[model samples]
Each structure stands twice: as C-alpha cells, then as structure tokens.
Target: GAGVSQSPSNKVTEKGKDVELRCDPISGHTALYWYRQSLGQGLEFLIYFQGNSAPDKSGLPSDRFSAERTGGSVSTLTIQRTQQEDSAVYLCASSLASSGAQHFGDGTRLSIL
Candidate 1:
C-alpha cells in the first residue's frame, strides 16, 4: 500500500507486558496521527506529528504510553506495563496538514490479557 501502513495487524500480550506498534505514512505527508478505537470509547486521539515537530502531546492517555517519529516518516507507539484496559484497535493516519483530509490504515488490534 502506498498510504498509511500499520504492521502486525493483531497482537496479544499479557498484562504488565510491553508492546510497540509501528506506522508508516504516505510519502511527503507532513502530518501523522495515532488514535485508539475501543468498544467503549469509539475513537480517541493519541498523538500526532507535523513535519519534524510535535505541537501537541495532550491526547496521550498516560505516561506509560509514548510515541516518536523518526526522519519524519516512520512512527512508533510504545506502551509499557500494558493492562487489559489498554486493548483496542490502534489507528494511524496521515495528511498534508492538520486540517486536511486524512488517509487511514487498517489499524493494529491489540489485546491485553
């Protein structure tokens, strides 16, 4: 796919384990976003990167969860000491700008035991 790509479509890990999810955005897209979709929470924004700078980091749910974008192309989300409540579909999207239409990937379904 030439668009947003997320790896390892599904994952299962025990509580207290750590997990890392990857997202590769479309070429030349300067803005990338991460979101979480859960049965109870619909879509919750996690984080995003614009160019090589991050203007916002408020959407992250906790200190245990963090993300970084390197070379302004690939992004990785890391969750430490995972809990059952952390289970959800992690979605990745990219656009030309913050307000532009976003292109999304199939998402990574994470399950915590």
Candidate 2:
C-alpha cells in the first residue's frame, strides 16, 4: 500500500468480547504507534514499537490492552474483555524513525454494545 492501512473500518461487539485491530504501515518504516481517540477527546497514545527495541507499552491504559509490531511492519492491537468505555477510534501511525513525522491510517472505529 502507498500509505498506512488498517483493517475493519468499523467493529461492533458486545461488552466483554475481545477484539483485535490490525495496522499495516508504509513499507520500510521503522517506527509504529497506536493511539485511541474517544468522542470529543484528543488522541491518546497507546503503544509504539521502534526497530527491534522493546516496545513501549507505558501508554496503555490497562493490562487488557496490548499491541505488537511484527518484523517492523504490521502491527496488531488486542483489547481483552471489552467495555463500553473502550469504544473509540484506534489509529495507527508510522515514521521513518523515532523522530520522524508520522503517517497515520484511517483508523478502526470500535463500538461496544
């Protein structure tokens, strides 16, 4: 893809159900990030993987949320035991390196029923 790509533009699930969001960044990008945007709220950092270094998971809200970037390209975000509060647009971004400007995907909108 020419730009960042995300799977399942929209997802609706009952509370307690788990969901996984996928992100495919621009080829050759070495930095990948995940963020969440809630209604009327600004983007909140979730996690990021930079090269082969250990991923930074400090931004994750809880143990239920986890993300991983494989081979420095595709990334996945998993939410366990979903709750209504977890509803949000999950955005993914990538940069050439840790300090480079990021390119973002359209995002995956998750709804909890």
Candidate 3:
C-alpha cells in the first residue's frame, strides 16, 4: 500500500526551461488526476486519466503542459516551456474510480526562477 509519491518535492528552475515531475499512484487504483495550486490560489485541475481511456486534458492550461500514464500506475507531467506563472505545487491524486474521493500526494513544488 504505497499510496502516492511525487519526486523533487521542491524544484527551482529558470523560466523557459523544461521540467518533468513524476507521480506513483496506489496499486489497483484506476483513476489518476493532476492539479496545480498556485500561491494563494485554489487548486486547478490539469488532467485526468482512467484505466485505458483517453485522458481528459481539457483542464490543461496550455500546450506547454502535458501528462501521460503508463501501465495505469505511474504518471509524469512535463512542462515544455516553463514560465514564472507556472510556478505552483503540482499535485497528483488517485482513487478507486473517477468519481471516488481522491487521496493526494504532497506534490512537487515547482518554482520558476
């Protein structure tokens, strides 16, 4: 029962650079979601994936943001061209199903310099 785990709990990168954040979901969970919480702002949904279905990318802020889940267990979020405005805590969560209550990870705090 390894819950969910995220890497580089804190990351500082220069603007315009690319950064990849990783997430490991709990075993047997088929729903995974990504969200971003900016300083003093509410959580914004980024993307969601369930089983082998097409990912819901409607919430992705821009083309610069993308994510992929492999084997329905691990996921990675990639920012192609980082910007100061993109600095936020990238949270990953998972649940038994898309509509179930999600368990959240501490998140990878990305800071664009």
Candidate 4:
C-alpha cells in the first residue's frame, strides 16, 4: 500500500494475554508515530520514531507498553499483560519528516475480555 498500513484490524483477547500490533509506514517516510484513541477520546501519543534517533517513548502510559521501529520502516507496538483499560484503537502515522504532515492508517481496534 502507498499509505501507512496496520495489521489485524480487530483483535479480541483475554485480559492477561499479550498482544503485538504491527505498523508499516509509507515507503521513504522518515518519521513514524503510534497513538491510541479510546472511546470518545482524542488521540493520545504513545511513541515516536524519527530516522535513526532514539524513539520518544515518554507518551507511553506504562512499562507494559513498548514499541520499536526497525530499519527505519516497519514498527510494532507490544502490550504485555493486557488489561481492559488497554482496549482502544491503535493508530499509526508517518510523515516525510518529523515536522511534516502525517498520513494515518485506519487503525487497529483492540478489545480485552
């Protein structure tokens, strides 16, 4: 796809399980971001990756959440020991540069049981 792509559009899992969400950004985009949107809530930044610089993970809510962008392209967000509160739509976006406009994916909806 020419735009950002996220896998497993919907995920339903037990509360205690772990889940991995994948994001493939637009080719040649040097900046990628991960965000979460809960029901009726605005998007919350989770992580950011710009080129080879260290990823900005300060937005992550807890240690259980982590993400990584590999080879400056595909990125993955992993949630360990999922909880009901973790349920939300995970959105992926990419831009030509950190300050450029970003293109977003449809997002992956996660449901915790």
TM-score of each: 0.95, 0.96, 0.95, 0.96
TM-score of the candidate numbered 1? Answer: 0.95
Please report, as a residue range, the 10-residue window in candidate 2 with the lowest summed lDDT. 93-102
Q: Report the candidate with higher lDDT, 1 versus 3.
A: 3
Give the per-residue lDDT of model 3 (tens digit) for 1-113: 57789997999999999999999998888999999998677899999999999999999999999999998889999998899999999999999984578999999999999
Candidate 2 per-residue C-alpha lDDT over 10-63 given as tens digits, one digit per residue, 9 for 90 to 100: 999999999999999999899999999997678999998999999999899999
lDDT of 1 by residue, 25-73 (tens): 9988999999999999999999978986754678999999999998988
Model 1 has an lDDT value of 0.92
Better of 3 and 4 by lDDT: 4
In order, how many clashes per candidate? 0, 0, 0, 0
Supply the TM-score for candidate 4: 0.96
Best by lDDT: 4
Q: Among all windows of ten consecutive residues in candidate 1, which has the lowest summed lDDT?
A: 48-57
Overall local distance difference test of candidate 4 = 0.94
Q: For residues 10-85, could you state the per-residue lDDT of candidate 4 as single tens digits?
A: 9999999999999999999999999999977679999999999999998999999999888999999999999999
* Runs off by more than 4 Å, candidate 4: none
Among residues 3 or more apart in sequence or in different chains, the pairs in candidate 4 whose N, CA or C atoms overlap within 3 Å are none
